[model samples]
Target chain A: MNFAQPVYYPKADYIETDTGNKVSRRATIAGPQNIILGGKTIISSTAIIRGDLRRTGPGHAVVISLGKYCLISEGCILRPPYKTYRGNFNYYPMKIGDHVHIGANTVVEAAMIGNYVEIGKNCIIGKFTMIKDCAKIADNTVIPPNTVVPALVLFSGSPGQFVENLPESTQELFESQTKQYYNRFQPLEG
Target chain B: MAPIKDRFTIHSKAVVCQDVDLRGEITIGSGTVVHPKATIFAITGPIVIGANCIIEEAVIIINRKKEVMRIGDENLFEIGCRVECPSIGDFNTISTRARVHYTLRLTSYCVIGAGCLVVLPEEEVLEEHTVIYGPASERRVWSGRGHIQELDLRRKHSEYLRETLPKFNRLRRGDGA
Candidate 1:
């Protein structure tokens, strides 16, 4: 196999490292390992990213792949391999695409998340849930497991029902706004 | 202290910090705070409380079999209120010692007076600041339309003054406005 030069730290943004001691910052990180924070993503105070690959099976290890310019707010739990109802199998790795905004107190244990997704406060996204790109989930929503959310759709309510689809221009605006959030993270705030 | 039965199954995401007594299939939403000594039982149907609600102390939220109870967010069920209503809207307030029974639904921002009886004699809407003093004499207003029992000497004088100008209505109307 011919050797190709590896691209080191591809994305430009802020990223905070949380190994054991907390290095909370609004930054992004890039890597193939577990808990790959997109270069320049802000992980707020007391935010725990349990990106241990050993929890999942070997080779297909677990990872919290947060995309570029994503803001995971305070007190949010983004567990990639979450426990299932059967009490045996855990869910797969969580894939959060670029420009996603996750509010406070949201517990998301899902397999995939699309780009420009905005999840409001106090929402509990069940395990193995697949959120389509540009979808909006309102506050206080409880999205059950195994849900296949469509693109540009609005999710609201207790069990969460499809409200309406967002326009393309609005989706673009939402996606572009998170870059400013990534830039605002000052390491001195610690 | 009573026996702790495994009736309610709270999700791991729910933040239930205080010690409260709950029975039957009660699903408390995320960020809901059930204060200490608040007892809730869904003996008949399920009691579903939405997120960000505060159930204060000594409040009992019970639902009989075949009847479901739903509560919206940011509601405060004050101390010692006995609520058996089927549904209550968001941002509502239930005052202390109020007896709510057979209530079909209470809309948002509605207020129940203290020591009052909020019930459906035959499914009626008791709008904001609705009050009822005596048992079985649940009148819409303090007029002689519904069962108005005679009061004692001091209470009769107070009743006369109440008929002229319901001061609580004036004060509570200020609250509603």
Candidate 2:
């Protein structure tokens, strides 16, 4: 199979959201097709979410997995590997959780992010940095490699620190924001 | 020292680069080296830097309105000096291990030693290598904060602030416009 042809949005059977918005896909990478969509997940145009572009083996292609109700903003880059053997490279099998809003131009190499997380724009979440659930990270904050963020906290800065706990007033805001994002891109049913 | 009346103008050949965001009305002089990974943000006022100065790595120069970060020529912010207040004077050599948090208006040919957290609001004179600190913490052994906490706070804070802040149209220099 020629892998040079750019992959297009699934044409035959894609559940459409009630908002009449099909997940827009433009200028994507080539690899093994491994996509997982649950509830309402909208992948925006000009967003690159896929696995590596190298040869894995027979019966194995690249694997790009998106969880249920994950909204990756425009210009976001998510690179997951197609096979487990190629997982030795740092940022393969990128895992994102439910009710997450990744801002524009944010580069996430995170293997996993807990639910209810809000990341700001121009931020770079480096490899192996696990941000726990209900954590709100401020914009331009760089989470360096091998950093562990505890749950329900607010992190900001170049190196990032636990400035304070998530205030009670902002908890509802965080929860509702995640729900709104997920609701906006819920996949349409057949 | 006393507060000045006007903004300091800089030459246009200032070297500002690498992961930096220069904001608000600020003037950077020619031959000034604002090194890689440095940030200069002026939200409420203007930032003025003089000619022939060197602002080293990871330095943060911020000024509130009515209190701008006014830096002088040939002075050096050597590696990680965070001057949040104005009143830093000319020919001052702020070492790598120093963090000046308060307003300090010094004359030319002075030195702020490394690992010093000098908070003197009044004018003072220091010989080269003289470490200064708060009067209450005088004679205390100076140690650095090791890691910066405000960078993350600033990153998180900039998110909320930028949403409502006035967007300054970066003048496209005819190359990418």
Candidate 3:
């Protein structure tokens, strides 16, 4: 319930797409055609979305598919996971569900992140990590590679372990928070 | 803002994305892959990155000291990591969100784990096979014997990036040989 104040950004800095995606002009999005943003997504300044890292030997695969009301804060890097399988290197596609909020300076190399997930500032979601719905990761947490986080849990600390079960109301709270954040992000008044 | 003088000498075989902000004099060796949004700022001196290095997205390599910064071959700078060190030897891996302060000089086969900060009081050179990790910045020396597998993996990874990245992303045009 942080109804404190609305944050205003310079209108010149962001490009509001047809689907209401407010992407900063400074954000470097590689391979825009391979990324699908559902809508109302805010990609702040210096955030990099690596959609060019698609699967090899593929016929036009989608690299990063993000759902509605997602927020990629400043200095965040979102790159798809890759691995050597059967003596061949391959990059996997990353999927993020709705109302997901990734904080500032976070580097996410996850395979999948489910709905209503809130990842805190400076966190590193490791390679091929899968996060279930309504999961929350605290600031400076480093989730290990191939770790699977269960639903409705709070993950904290380096080599992030499940600290506690989140309240059942987490989904509703996260949804509202994301929606409010999107609404409150307005252009500076003249 | 004043215009930045771009003095970059990228090898023809290297894959440096067009979106990378390369300022001052920098030399990228053959088989190196510099991903988009990676920043290489040589403020005080030149930076020479060796062959088969992988500089992932948002990685920042800054040379703020007077001496030249020389990074050796087969290095991997993972996403969002910051390197301000003056010298880094071959086969080092600086993982995600890690910070290598200007005071530390890394020798060959060092691994700075994710989110770790290497900030010594003054200039210190780390020995080979040093692995600095965790929130507490614990230090350990990995046995160099029987560890050829990691370097092999890195070589394969960089080779894959050098081949596939140009097919998807627009590469920065190399000035000269």
Q: Pick the candidate with the highest lDDT.
A: 3
- Each candidate's DockQ score against the native complex? 0.02, 0.02, 0.66
- Scanning candidate 2 chain A in windows of ten residues, the lowest lDDT window is A81-90
On the 0 to 100 scale, the lDDT of residue A166 in model 1 is 85
In the range A117-158, model 2's lDDT, one tens digit per residue, is 889886667656788888988986767666889888999876
Q: Report the Cα lDDT for residue A166, model 2.
A: 84
Clashing pairs in 3: none
Candidate 1 lDDT, tens digit per residue, B1-177?
A: 334333554544344433466777777765565544468888767888886566644578988747668888667675457888788877666754567886446766566644456656676555543444433425443333222221122223222222322211121111112
Interface RMSD of 1: 28.3
Docking class of 3: medium
Model 3 interface RMSD, one decimal: 1.2
Better of 2 and 3 by lDDT: 3
Q: RMSD in Å for candidate 3, one decimal?
A: 2.7
lDDT of 1 at B164: 22
Candidate 1 local Cα displacement, residue B52, angstroms:
31
Candidate 3 on A119-151: residue-level lDDT in tens? 999899999999999999999899989999999
- Candidate 1 chain B — worst ten consecutive residues by lDDT sum? B167-176
